[model samples]
Target chain A: GESVGLHLPTLSVQEGDNSIINCAYSNSASDYFIWYKQESGKGPQFIIDIRSNMDKRQGQRVTVLLNKTVKHLSLQIAATQPGDSAVYFCAESGPSGYSTLTFGKGTMLLVSP
Target chain B: EAGVAQSPRYKIIEKRQSVAFWCNPISGHATLYWYQQILGQGPKLLIQFQNNGVVDDSQLPKDRFSAERLKGVDSTLKIQPAKLEDSAVYLCASSLAWTQFYNEQFFGPGTRLTVL
Candidate 1:
């Protein structure tokens, strides 16, 4: 059975501060991991992705780190803004390409302005 | 480039009533997927189609749910005799065909369903 879960259900941060969200997965066969940001009433938007071959990946203001040994994943947002307030989800696809992605229970990131 | 399209934006129905949702994937995408997102939870896969054929429907509740993709393009998902537990947001997403290492799934604004 493949399942992904987040360590925290809600993360609150002051404006302009940094935020870190963590996730853990049960499947070792997962090869690809992605982070998505979802605003109220909107779909989850792609933020960044990291592959098992790589330990870390960076985007405009976000970063995703993969720890295969612990089967853990993390997303970091620097200088978090009010606009960044939303639910963030981590998803994973397996060693096989074109496989169904398993998504973790999202973590709501509330950035206070 | 347009993203995936789904309708109606919202629906309210009573339990035991039937409902259906329509989805149009991004042009040229070979894979289409439907997901159910309950409040406070991540999206769960309902069904997947690689063109007009079914690739996976393992998580789908086949007893009351049904879906189809004709001509490998547009798709529809239907639930007969809906239950209160069937209430959730239905999301549609698509991705380009097998392209080696990168296959990004573009999602559409989902349809919010409420069964009272």
Candidate 2:
């Protein structure tokens, strides 16, 4: 069975510090990966995504690094703020036409001011 | 553009009761998805629709769950004779189309269901 999982259950960081959340996926066929942020009582919001063809992708304040050799993925947030506190999920999808996403157990990111 | 829209922000029902949730995807989007998010976990895909047709429903509990997407627009998911373990958030998401490449899915504020 294919599974995606986070390395940490929770990560606490101080404001103005950097945060890195790690994930491990078991599916070698997974070509598309995405990161989502979910606040309390809200749906998951898309943050950043990277394709298997690319190793790194950067958004406004976030970066996603994918290591195919180890099947590891990481999300890095710069200058973490209280507003960035939420549960972060890493999802992977196969190379099918539908591309159904399989999400991992989330990592709670707590940024304290 | 408006994001995905869902109704009944919250619901409370007893075991064996039935509940239905509604969702309206973004305009012109051809793909819709339903997911269940348990506490402290990530969302799991339950069903997927493409233009009023069923693309995938392998994860959906067929004995207790049913969904329909009519006219290739709005969709509704129903759960009959629910169980306590069914209590979770039902999220609806939509994308422009079903593709092999990156097609970002926009999600709606999910409906929280509590089964007592």
Candidate 3:
């Protein structure tokens, strides 16, 4: 079945440094993508999202880059902080109008101070 | 505003037993979703409800798993004769409406279930 996946299972970085998490999706028909942050013992929180029509979208200190030609997506966080330590997941939804999301395995991001 | 709410943060039940989890979505939200998230993996949609009607439930184990969203507000997910593989976190989320375009969903803390 078509699915979403990540390049790295875990990413470690020091505080104040930049971090980039990469995801690869197999469904070309998907039109919308979202990045979520899940802390320990909590549900996933929406971070940022990008539509297929756009190549890039930015929110707060996070940026989402979408490459439809390769079916690849990436999330960039500027000035990483300790609070950013969590599992980050990239979810895809779409060719239809409904908002059903298909999530990836997720990449754990560790930010050490 | 309050986010989605779920009950019984944790539950431990033996296999073959029955367990039910409750959820209360954000006020005025017309769409509700239930997802199962196993350890180290991302949340998988189990069912989706538009108002009180089911919109999607293809992934749900209909033989053993059942759900209901009554009054278009609170919902309950029940598992009969639970299996060990049912051990996972159940998350409830709600969106203002179901649209062709993207609508942000607000998630609850989640209910952790352990089927031993």
When superposed on Cα atoms, how far off is each prediction in RMSD?
A: 4.0, 3.9, 3.9
lDDT of 3 by residue, A1-113 (tens): 11112343889999999999999987899989999999888889999999899999999999999999999999999999999988899999998558589998799898999
Tens-place lDDT per residue, model 3, B1-116, is 88899999999999999999999999999999999998888999999999999999999999999999989999999999899999999999999999888899889999899999
**lDDT tens readout by residue for model 1, A8-66:** 38889999999999999778988889998887777778899898999998888888889
| Candidate 3: residue B88 Cα off by (Å) | 0.4
Which 10-residue span in candidate 3 chain A carries the lowest summed lDDT? A1-10
Off by over 4 Å in 2: A1-8
Q: Which ten residues in a row have the lowest lDDT in candidate 3 chain B?
A: B98-107
- Per-chain TM-score of candidate 2, chain B: 0.98
Compute the DockQ of candidate 2: 0.46
Worst 10 residues of 1 chain A by lDDT: A1-10
Sort order, DockQ high to low: 3, 2, 1
DockQ of each: 0.40, 0.46, 0.48
Tens digits of per-residue lDDT for model 1, B5-108: 99998899999999999999999999999999887789999999988999999999999999999889999999998999998889999989754465888899
lDDT-based ranking, best first? 3, 2, 1
lDDT of 2 by residue, B1-116 (tens): 89999999999999999999999999999999999988777899999999999999999999999999989999999999999999989999999999766689899989989999
Question: What's model 3's TM-score?
Answer: 0.96
| Number of the candidate with higher lDDT, 2 or 3 | 3
Q: Is model 3 an incorrect, acceptable, medium or high docking prediction? A: acceptable
